[model samples]
Target chain A: MRSYLSRTTAIIGMGLLWLAALIEIYPIILVVFSAVKSKPELAVNPFGFPKEITFQFFATAYDTMHYFRSVSNTVLIACVSVVLSAAMTSMAAYAIVRRKNRFHSFLYMLFLAGMIIPFQMTMIPLYKMMVDLGLYNSYHGIMMIYLALTAPFSVFLLVGFIKSVPRELEEAALIDGCGIFQTFFRIVLPLLKPALTTLCVLNLFSVWNDFLMPVLFLPDDKKMTITVQISKFQGMYSNDWSLLFAGICMIVLPMVVIYLLAQRFIINGITAGAIKG
Target chain B: MQTNLRQKWKINGIWLLFVLPALLFYLIFLLLPTLSATYYSLTDWDGVTSTFIGLDNFRAMFQDRLILASFRNTLQYTVSITIVQNGLGLLAALLLVRAFRGVNALRTMFFMPHIFSGLVMGYVWGFILEPNIGALNNVLEFLHLDALKMSWLGDPSVARWMIVFVSSWQNLGFSMVIYIAGLQGVPRDLYEYSDVEGASRWRKFASITFPLIAPSFTINMILCLIGNLKLFDQIYSLTGGGPGFATESIASTIYKVGFYNGIEWGYGSALSIVLFLCILLLSVTMVTLLRRREVEM
Candidate 1:
């Protein structure tokens, strides 16, 4: 009797899970379907399978989006910003963890406070400062801003993770005549892989999907990031479903591919970041 | 003593070296800009020049009906997303905690929306919900349901809710994933004991699962509250603050006032500060209140 009741519950549970999954995935599937359908086909059969697939929309979207340039530009900014931000913040987090002084504790609090200051609050002054400093529309300039924006959260996450790391390893490295830098780079950093991976992944998503910063600071077509370009493309082609869908496919596909490739790490990374915070 | 003091100075100096890069970036980009923004909020700066207007910008903010309307909209948007996303997320997590076939694929699908930018999601959903040629309306028409085919994003009454629904739809998976992690963290012994005692499912959950996942509750609620309070991208792409400012978020309004409308930098800065305070107060209150609940549980 018990086994039968439990089995029924399990089946019911699985049914609900699949239903939720279908709801989550259906819109995405429709977008992909519409991307390949011809204009007439899209109008007639919006949700069904396309009778004939076409790559012409993809081709047009590619040129109009400046697919390669904007994508590479986005990748450049995301990668450099993620790498540099992680390096700097991790080092700072390490210092705060190891030193354990009043100043370090105060610094830690300051960084945590930074998390409360919304981007909107800083938008006007930051833009003015960028223009005044001649850093507007430049890759490095934007990268610097991304680093600052990410610093607070990165420091918060890293500090939590780093405290769990045993001090004995670093002490052993120090006693072996290794300097602080060497001990840090060789011993402490390699030990921070899980945390660093989590931070890097989160930073990548923020920098890549970020719309406002690039729109405000890098307005030039030559300097546009993928999100900005997609927004622009979206505005211009709002009426053309076929073209707009193709453009969206371009913007979404790369992230999808990356997510699929790194599903385990990405999931665990996000889970860890959320749980620790 | 002199030698020991010198050694302490050397150690602190090296630590300073390690901290300098992040500090410089924070100071120049974050802290300095924040301080300057506070100053600008007090003045009537038009991006080019400024006059010290004292509390004029802030006083003007209270008189501006547009600001008040957007604030109300933002609060509604945040409250709706918080409840819907977390409610459905907790439900999904309860089902997903049990082992089953193809569960990994299901998890992947649920988290897939996190990959798409909000801009792209808004546009895609915008296409789906277009009243005239949208897939949704077409489906409704096919099913002989003409009454359900009004302008989805055009009606002021429906558009705000649609924005809330779309925002939650994009992130429901995220909240699920977080809750799943939280649920998994609950030890199995409690559930085992409950099962042996023949406790009702709701009894077991309320007594065990709910209390155990208090941290996740706090995390999901505060994160959603903070993120939705600063809603921008989705609002920008979906409604552009709308059929008649029906969905203008404070963040979008700040953009319009600061840059797009006429560069009302001073007033924009004041609005920004207000947003910061709203987020700060709410998040802090939630953290303390929720943490107390966790302790009580």
Candidate 2:
């Protein structure tokens, strides 16, 4: 009886895992396979291996979406914004945490309040601000907006991580003749690598995959990011399943590749991000 | 005493120097926008013109059918995503607790979708659930289950559910990862004690595992609530608030009303302020309620 019970439980576990694996990958598999199949094959063999595979769709999508420019625009925007948020927020969080004053709590509430305020509330004014700044369709304008949007969360996350760091080390660094900026850059920043990485990767994903800001700010196709580019493609190719399949794949594949390569860091980064903060 | 006061001022001055850049960005990008919402929401501001319109915008907002439905849909999306995402996450954490072959690969596959923007993910699902040539129906036909092969995005009810499903699928890995971390932190001794007492697996989890991971529960719940309430990208990419106002959330509606063609600047402002309030109220209440539960235990 005991042997039978153990076997039953083990089988059930495997079944559950299989169901989950399907749930996780079903749509994605359809997407991957759809990209490779001809339009006729997609309708006939949607769940099966592609009857004939071709890279034609990818080539088509690459040109249609202006893939190179969009990727560059996305990378440029994500990189600059993340770097700015990291440098600016980490320094601010460090100052706030180290002060040990009422101002820290006041700043905390301010950030927490900022967190609850949706972008929609201020999006109009922000768009107008971008227009007035002569950056409505430029990369720098979008980059500045992203930096502003993500800063509060980054500051909040780092503040939590910063509190857990003992001040004794920083004091010792100060005693060893390191200035405050030097202590922060050389000592505290090193200790914050894990949290910093978490913040950067998370920020990178948000900025890279962002649609609303890019659609609104970078209205010009030349300035458009990949997400917005494909969205526009979807509109043009709404009826053309074959071309749309390839377009979606072109947009999704790079991120999927990046995630696969950096799976360990990505998972570890977010885990630390959540558990500590 | 005078020297102490001077020293305090000097310390503040030094710290403020370090934080100035961040504060400047926050003042312009975040704080300014938040404060400006009040003025815009109450006025007849349409980019080129501005006039104080009092509560007229708010009054018009309540009578707007699409706005009402959008707010209702937003609430439903939040509640459903929170419960389902957390429930599935806890289950994944439980299953993955015991190390097995391909565990790492499974976790990676699960998390891979989340890295994509929700808009792209929506488009991916849009093709899969596209009625005639869609993968979902294609499979149903092959299985001879043609009755189940409904146009997934056609019906109002089914369209919203598909949005929820796609959102949950994309976000499951995030919730699961957090829960697994929470599970790892639950002390092994408690489980050992339960085992010694011959308690059932479910009972052990109920009595110990669940309570210990209460903090993760709170964090995950708050994150989902805030994120879903502010949802825009998925609805935009998937349904476009369509088949005639079926799956519209306020986030999507705001963009449509404000920027789609002729901008209803003041009306959109009022719509978003309402969204902001809903998020603030719901999140604060949830955190307090969940924290109370944690203390009660």
Candidate 3:
């Protein structure tokens, strides 16, 4: 009798989770379905499979949103900015971690404090600065903004990781007649892989999906990132739900694919960053 | 001693070289703007020219009805989102603790939303909640629950709730992941110990599991609180603070006033400063309260 009751409870638990799972993916499923369905089909069979699978919606979305150009721009911008931000911040973190001095400690605290100051506080002046520098629509300008915006957390994360690294590794590098840059490029960076990977994945998701910097700085359609392009598309094509679905799917596909491919790394990296904080 | 001093100066220079780029970026992009926000808040700056106005912007904020409504709505959002995300997350984490077949797939699906930006998720939900031929209302009609179907974003009262719901849906997976980590930190032996002694599941959870995961609770709450307080991307895409400022948050209002509207940059800075103060106060208070509890535990 007890076994029967326990079995029933287990079944109920499984059933509840299944319902939650369905709810979680239901919107996503509808979205993917909308990507292929025509406007008439979408209106008629909002939740059902499309009667005719039209590839034209995706093509129209691609041309309208400039998906190819915007995607490559997003990728390049994220990659370049992440590389610069990671390099600079990791170097700063290495110095702060290894060189124990009052100045370095103050510097560490400064970067730490930067994390809490809301970006809204900086947005206005940053916009003006970008315009004044003739960098409003430039890729490098956006990259610089990203580097600045992301530095604090990247520094904090790297500082924590670098502190855990043994001092002897650096001392040995020095003894081997390695330059400071070489030491960092060779020994420290390779060692900082896990933390760097965490920062990289986090930054990729953020920078690619970044809207404010892109919206304010990269106003030109030719220079816009995927997120900015989609927002612009949404604003103009508000009534075109079918096209919106296609554009959104295009925007979401890379992120979803990356997440699926690197789920474990992404999860572990994020969890580590969280608990460490 | 002279040689040692020279070596120290030389080593410090090299170290400073490594630190220069990050220092320059932070100073230029972050520190300068933050300091200027305070300065700009005092002046009637329009990005081109400025005149010292001396707290007029601040005074104006207290009289602004939109600001007040946004504050109320944002506070409501922060409180509700924090509770629901953490509660639902904890429930999911607890249930999923014992891995079964397809647990990994379910976990992946749940967390898929977390991978995308809030902008995308908000846009996605914006369609799902559409009044006519939207998936949500369609589901309601199909189930013969037509009464529950309302204009999700059209109604003022309903819009804020819908924003809250979308924000929660987007972030719940994150909270769940955090809680799962917390749960895993709780040793398996405690559950085994309770099992041998035949403690009720609820009792075991309350006595052992809850206390063990208190740190996770603190982390999740603090994160959710800060994120919701600075809410913008989702609101920007989802509602644009509309159906007549129903779902407007202070963050969104700042954007509307400063960026989109392009007239009230000084006033925007003042409001942004206020929002920062709120976040700082809440975070500091939460840390203090939670830390005190943690020590007692």
Candidate 4:
């Protein structure tokens, strides 16, 4: 009787998880279904499959939203910001971990302090500065801001990973007459690949999906990133459910593809960061 | 040797070089803006003007009804969503801890919502909750439950709760994942020993499982509090603080006051300073409290 009860409980647990999964995935499926339906059909059959699938909504959303331009802008910003942030963070981490000076700990703590302050606190003044600097609608301005905002956590993560590298490896390279920069580039960095990949994926997702920063700082139509572009599309096409879903599908597809491709690393990176914190 | 001294200097200089780029970016972008926000909070400079009136911005903030409304709304959303999300997450974790076939796949599916962007999820759910042609209302109508088909995102009373529900749905997966990790870390031997001693399942869970996952509870609570406190993207895309200022949060209010409405720069800065202090103090207090509990355990 005990064994039977345990089995039944297990079955019920599995049922609950399945229900949760269905709820989690329902929106994505609904968005796709709505994206293909005509306007009248979407209103008529909100939950059912479309009787006829047409590509017109996709065409309209694409044209009105300027989907290609927004995609390029998002890709450019995320890529450039990730590269700059990774390089800067890793280099700084290398210095702090290897040198182990009094000032190093102080600086590390300063970066960690940045993590506690919410970004909302910085938005107002940052917007004012951007306008004053004549970078209110420029790609470089947004990219630079992202680089700065992402640097602290990237630095924190890299510092923890870099500290784990054996000192003997660096010492051996130094004994062989390799310079400090040479040691970092050739010997130390190669061993830090796992951490590097993790940071790259994490930073990529954040920079790509970020809406608030781009909305405030890059509000100009031509300079908008994907998230801001989608917001604009929603604002304009608020009554047109099909078109809105198409826009959502366009914005979500790339991230979904990327996540599927690097699921394991992404999972590891998130769990590692959480458990360590 | 003299050569060794020169080598040491070069290494130190190179180390400084390595730190320069990140430091330069942080100083110019983050530190400068944060400090300027503090300085601007003391003034009455509109965003476009050069004039300053010291401390008037903050003095005005205390008198503004909209600011007070936003503070209340933000606190309401944060506290409710944090409690519900964490509660549901813990329940889900408890259920998932018992081994079953296809459990790993179930875990992945449960976590999938967390991986999606909050903006996308908000928009998707916005469609789902629309009163006229939303799937939710249609389902309710088909079920012959007309009384249950109230305006989900349109009514002031219901809108805040709807936002809470969406926020919980988006975040519960993350909390569940954390709890699962915590649950797995608890040794199985404790459960077995309790079973041998004829402890009921409830007693074993209360005694063994609860204390062990105290650290997880602390971490999850702190993260949920901070994340919900700074909520903007989801609220922005979903409601835009609509139905007559019923759902305006601190971040939304700051954005409106600063950029959208009329660029009240000093006022916005004052609000930002208040938010920063609230987050800072809350986080410190929470960490201290949680750490103290961990020690007691």
Estimated TM-score per prediction?
0.97, 0.96, 0.97, 0.96
* Residues B1-297 of candidate 3: C-alpha lDDT, one tens digit per residue: 999999988987888999999899889988988888888899898877889999999999889898999999999999999998888888888877667898888888777777787887788888888899888888889899999999999998889988888888888888999889989999989889999999998999898999888888888988899889988988888888898888899888988888777767888888888988998898899989987887887
Q: Assess candidate 2 and give its TM-score to the true structure.
A: 0.96
True lDDT of residue B4, candidate 4: 100
Query: In candidate 2, which residue pairs get closer than 3 Å at backbone N, Cα or C atoms, i.e. clash?
Result: none
lDDT of 2 by residue, B3-37 (tens): 99999888678788888888888888778877787
Candidate 4 TM-score to native: 0.96
Fnat (0 to 1) per candidate: 0.73, 0.69, 0.68, 0.65
For each candidate, report its DockQ versus the true two-chain complex: 0.77, 0.70, 0.74, 0.70
Q: What does candidate 4 score in Cα RMSD to the true structure?
A: 1.9
Interface RMSD of 4: 1.4
- Clash pairs, candidate 3, are none
What is candidate 4's lDDT per residue for A112-157, written digit by digit as tens? 7888777877888888789899988899999899888998889888
Best by DockQ: 1
Candidate 2 segments exceeding 4 Å error: B1-11
Q: Judge candidate 2 against the unseen true structure and give its global Cα lDDT, from 0 to 1.
A: 0.85
- Candidate 2 vs candidate 3, DockQ winner: 3
Deviation of model 4 at B144, angstroms: 1.3
